[model samples]
Target: MSDLVSVAAIKDLLTECPICIEHFDDATRIPRRMPCCVQSICQPCLESYSGGAATLSCPMCRRRHNLPGGVKSLPKETVILKTLDYLKIQKGLHLPCTDCPDKEIAVAQCDNCGTFLCSICLSAHKRNTVSKTHTINTFDEMKGRPLQSFRRLHQCSQHQQPVQFYCYTCDKVVCVSCTVVDHKEGKGHNVVSVNEAHQGKAKSINDVLGKIEEKTKRLSETESALQKKIENIKLSMKVARDDINKIFDNLKDRLNQRRTILLSDVEGKSAENLKVTEEALDSTRLLLTKVKSSSEYMRQMRNKADKVEDLQVMGSSKASLNSMLKESPQEIPFDRTGVSFVQANVQHLQNTINVAGMVRSVTFSPTERPNGIPDTAVHNVITLEPAEFPTD
Candidate 1:
């Protein structure tokens, strides 16, 4: 119940060290505010500022101030530190005991020393005469509330003194002792408070972040459009392939119908010719039989009866033959109706597709198109090439 941060409190959290643009860590991020400009700077920058000087200068305002007691004299910003505490609570962090070897969780935080303590360590700390008067709070009280900003005693690289001031010209954080003993206050060096610097930089970063968000949104839309285009292309190709197959199927049906018709024609014409030839053969056989009968009758008449009987049979046969001859030709003529298929050049038909591929009727127009069509979208000849069928 005590581990929660309010929405209004969340807005007040310090997410990063303004000087380094890095996220604030409890162990490293020590928040310090200068007196002249009331600006907050990280502990590292402060330690670097008070290099060898008894006096410190505000980076933004270039205002100089005396630092009698050094970096420890810098004021603590309570609001900023409270923001850090909220962040720790957000991460569900349990304060670790400083003296514990395994980094055991601590139950209380020392206000004077800024160190967390377990029950054993807390009792020991309380019993000690030095820490007996120090203020201590349970972990529950420490969470969900703003705490005072604390600065570590970081020794300067140059004079081993705590850094107190920031140099504007050099963009370096130095100690107040360095200003007097080492770096004398020089002209053309402008300095101001960390708050003013942090505010200016935060504004600039926000502008960039806004632009990045807009670009990200636009890119997302573009990606969606591209995906739709790809799907559309796939659909069109599938439809085209289906249409091509249907066209070939129709061609095969037509060819099969043509074959059936040709076969029917051949059968009808051959049947008619066979019928005529059969009739002619029957008539000829009848005539031959009659002639043979007549000759046999004549031989019989000559041997037995007389010339009268023979003349009667021969006269009947001659009359019948004359009638048959008068009706049609002596020999039956063969009448033939030829059937053939005119097949196309198979190679030429195959090459026709290649010809279609190379052929293009393009048009260049500067005038506006009629209706709602754009001139840029217009083309004279359009050819569709379908994708290859996937094997696997």
Candidate 2:
């Protein structure tokens, strides 16, 4: 579970655009590298921020960049895109076909229609007369193909025709008929063929790609370091758990030993006390028997005596009985046992138990730690907060 979460955290850090902070996708949110800072920004964010300007400032470093053609000219961050693709494949993910009602996996994409298709949908699409001439590429053939090489046509709203031209003055893509009727050059509109504008932006795009290549190399190194950090965290957790178990196991042994000593002490003293009391009880029973026997003899002699001898025997018996009765039963020695348990300092033991183990976390300096993680302190305790990644 820990490993899964850590890997997800690393992916979240690597796949997000620095500008919009959204995960990069193959469609509108595709990552594009800026020449100024060599930072990856999503395509939609660039389009919105550029706002048809001739130059755009880098969101990270604030360095101005010339948009010779438009945001479309900026090269895609191919490294990040490839990483995302590889991860998706590893996870067994499949993008759904655009034409499938039941969400079938896409096997091919139509360049002309700009829609993905499953095998069944592709067969139907090829059979349709309207789309029979459209250019389609299977997933295998599309591998490593540059995104800019694919041509997607959009229909002009006014003319309902394929847009083939760009009107710089109106800042819109227009069809040939629209250019003639509504966006003519004579009407102060600067219009140019899409090919011509693309050619003009080729040099700038190449320059950005070169910078992005270097940036991606650094990103790769950072990713490797992050992977190492995750492994380290897992190892640390395992070690801590083992330590906790060992300490508690030793404590249990000591407690059991103490308990056995206390029980033995009580049992031994109780046995000794029982022997002493039994001896005193035996002596008491013998003394009680003698007194009762003498009293009965005196009573018989007085009732049946008829001569001087009987009288003499009665007097002697009475004297002896009185002397025995005068002796106090309380004076007989019988020692009582005080064998019991006395509780130790409960609060002290409670305090010791509470502090017996601790989970500690430490923050390392920038030079000592991997990328993505910042040097943030959480004292000397474990915390459950999410890891923060640097945006710039």
Q: Considering every candidate listed, which one attains the maximal TM-score? A: 1
Model 1 worst lDDT run, 10 consecutive residues:
354-363
lDDT of 1 by residue, 274-391 (tens): 4554555444433333333323322322233112222222322333333322332123332221122222222353433222111111112234356877666743333222222212
Which regions of candidate 2 are displaced past 4 Å? 1-16, 19-23, 26-59, 62-93, 100-103, 144-161, 180-182, 201-392
Against the unseen true structure, what C-alpha lDDT does each candidate score?
Answer: 0.45, 0.52
Across 110-189, the per-residue lDDT of candidate 2 in tens digits comes to 87886768999999999999999998887777665543343333566687787777666765557899888999998999
Q: Which 10 consecutive positions of candidate 2 have the poorest summed lDDT?
A: 1-10
Superposed by TM-score, candidate 2 places the C-alpha of residue 252 at a distance from the truth, in angstroms, of 65
Clashing residue pairs in all predictions, respectively, total: 33, 0
Question: lDDT at 126 for candidate 1?
Answer: 93
TM-score of 1: 0.36
